[model samples]
Target: MDELTSFVALGDSFTEGMDDPGPNGTYLGWADRLAGMISTHQPGLRYANFAIRGKMLQEIVDEQIPLAVGLKPQLVTFCGGGNDLLVPGSDPDALAEVYEIAVADLRAAGSEVLIFTGFDPKHTPFLRSLRGKIAIYNSHLWSVAERYHCRVVDLWSMSVLHDRRAWSEDRLHLSPEGHRRVALRAAEVLGFKPEDDWSTPWPPLDNEDWMTQRRHDLKWAREHVVPWIGRQLRGESMGDGLAPKRPELLVFDGLGSAEAGEAAWKSAHRA
Candidate 1:
């Protein structure tokens, strides 16, 4: 557990940071937050993010993993297969087999690996149906982490994430607040001492009417769910023709957590 000075992240939209936008409207997800935390101790930290939205697990293995291996960063975070498990008739058992090869590759290349389990999706509206599938994949991820001696972010056991505020309107990505908490958790996983606690509960809120809730669900389905289904049917991906935004392991513009730290982090990205 030496202080990891170099890091590479590989994943999909979740790692690309969809809903957690920076001040200039760029995505600054948990990875950057964790980098910022690490930089406090390891100022020479160099980081790269190979995550893109809508990337499948195989795509990540084929494209991103090789690049990461070449960089030979001290640590690699692999968190894909979510988009894979979401497809109808997709097999979690089969996906886990593919996932292990990627992890094994990273580990064999002399880099420590970190992996994330799927979150508990029961509280999510349309995605609640995929709960059992997600659970199955999460179990496999846990076993993989154990067998490979990799660090676990364990997103499934993150109780604070169950709150509605932790999710974006699309219900697939984390909100800014959700990203904040996740960064703290990631820092904890890496043994970095974050200033805030991720498990702190939010203040109580008033409930909406049942009819209003129904209307919101319908709106979500029409806007987000329908488009997602169409893309799946068409074999299209949001990451189609898109390259990794942060391809190199240099000083990422926004790489910090906490309120003041986040402001500075966003400003760095703006430069």
Candidate 2:
């Protein structure tokens, strides 16, 4: 809003750009893509991203929200509560309550806030069980957005994400293409005319036998799910020692390649 001279993004792995690896080994998610687009129009746009992987809603509110508000950005995008929904016995209502306070705080700080709903996980293997919970959380997110008058990026209804190819092997993070689509959708929500269309259908897929699919699921469990459970049991987080890729509001000059942007970001933070 107001030409978006400065912007900050807050959330978890999704906002951190998981599965969408950059050349320099960092994740470059939709927020970075959207910032690149904004920079094209406003070449000197200042932006920062405070997202880290495996962050819960409460952690995001506690750690990232204050930093984002202190930046005094013209716009801020937030997407959280997903990691909380993945945990057993977590309450969606309770998460939404805290989430609402974060939104209110940012809005009160005079920043145009953007929010996102959780994606529909029914199509993902081993994740269908949490579909009901995610739906509940999404509903609460919509209500919060309405109450706060914030823009909403409705990921739950983005049918393109239902395709298997849109997800990473972990089934939790989005694939590179998926992240690109999300960026375009975010641009649309912000009333920007994005070059690509998020709704474009993927090429037709070949059918796989049910047994083969089951085998794939088993492999996925061994490769991804088991490790995730192990980390949970050990009370470890993926972001244990990681820092945000972009920590300060600087000119978004390296919009073309996230790798270049990341290098510049690292240099800026180092100084």
Candidate 3:
């Protein structure tokens, strides 16, 4: 309530940190790093990551939303829906519905929602073939965030236009290095910074257990996050499957309603 006492992260692999291809992947994603930095300044805050690797809008609404509310933290961050665009024969309408549901839930929780914007599909190999659709999808995100008055993190603009090197091996998600940069940028934009500097490289994967864990983590992300994005982009709702089936109809459908700000908090991990 005062400063960010609690922080939550919701999203897909990008939010999960799928950069390191090695088996042991600790998901020190950008959100985690951002929390770390905030903690440096705030010290006693709580950090919760509700992110699932391939989570869709519905998944966040279903799972992450409740967790966020229960956590009762002050800050909630969401970065998602990338998989929605990657799936072949995906539906955008469903994706939007799911997103709306998630946003509604976040607002209801009184969170300072930060939605990361998507970039051009051309940034990735698969999406390269769907450039036009990517623009439409990103535009929809901007419009939706504006409607909710949620804080928009221009990841699309920052990643593609300003810092292209932020992408990882897959050219889709952010690399560990990219996540570090993003975390720092978020700190700068939000005016919060911890003692530890994430600009340097984090320790390398030192063991098989770590690698195995990382591999499992990444696999988990690919499964959940991607499908959700696909569902949303296709214009279908994941919960009841009754949402609209067209992206064009995304407009004028405020069949929805209302919401929620900010604070610095203690660091989570600074070594």
Candidate 4:
């Protein structure tokens, strides 16, 4: 309710900032964008992100949660379980049990928690199959937020994200513009009026015929989907041997340009 002096973000690639590439070739997704907005109001807000590209729910609970607890930030945003839900036989009910424990831990540590639902997958041809599972998991997330009194940013209801333009070429992570809109949504959830509105409609585009759509899907399947399946078969992850981008709750001022943001990121990494 009061000014959020510090924040920590935890989850997988979505939070790790995939397709939304920053200058210096790193990802700067919604969390970084949100941090910048908060700093505009608080002036010296401290923030950290413990998200990697391919983490599962259990990994986030076991690894990132404790670190987030240690930081004791005023706000901590939790988004996990999408990766687990993508697994062939994962159960949403069981995932929520583990998810609740992490929520409990953060709440007990006296931080206001912010949580997110998985973005609606119905628009993505390859990911549409997981819609039911994601919906089930999202229902559980809503219940968890209710029980813990946490703030929620309902990604599923954001009609803007259903557009093809909001996604990256992989049909997975959000595009830079997509992340920008999400940050604006998160700001609104926190009761702040952002500079831009998330609900603004995009300019019109020519419709792709069925054959053209099929060709694009096939190309994406070869470049992205097949390799993802191979990784699952061999028990490997894209984030293997990688570390959290922002491990400490360092101060964030939210630089304007990608170049400026990258310079600050490098300075932070050097520290």
Clash total of candidate 2: 0
Compared to the true structure, candidate 1 yields what TM-score? 0.93
Candidate 3's residue-wise lDDT over 175-216, tens digit each?
A: 656766677656655545444343544345354587885675
lDDT string, candidate 4, 1-271, tens digits = 5777999999999998898876566788988977876775677899999999999999999999999898888999999999888889999999999999999999999999999998788888778898998999999999999999999999999999988899999988998888878887887888776446788899998999999999999999999999999999999999999998888889874644755344222211100
Measured by TM-score, the strongest candidate is 4
Q: Runs in model 4 with CA error above 4 Å?
A: 253-271
lDDT of each candidate versus the true structure: 0.84, 0.85, 0.58, 0.86
Using lDDT, rank the candidates from best to worst. 4, 2, 1, 3
RMSD of 2: 5.2
lDDT of 1 at 108: 89
Query: lDDT value for candidate 1?
Result: 0.84
Give the TM-score comparing model 3 with the true structure, all chains together.
0.65
For candidate 4, the lDDT comes to 0.86
- Error of model 4, residue 28, in angstroms: 0.5
Q: How many residue pairs clash in each candidate?
A: 1, 0, 34, 0
The Cα error of candidate 1 at residue 140, in Å, is 1.0
Of the two candidates 2 and 3, the one with more favorable lDDT, higher being better, is 2
Task: List the pairs of residues colliding in candidate 1.
Answer: 253-269
The lowest-lDDT stretch of 10 consecutive residues in candidate 1 is 262-271
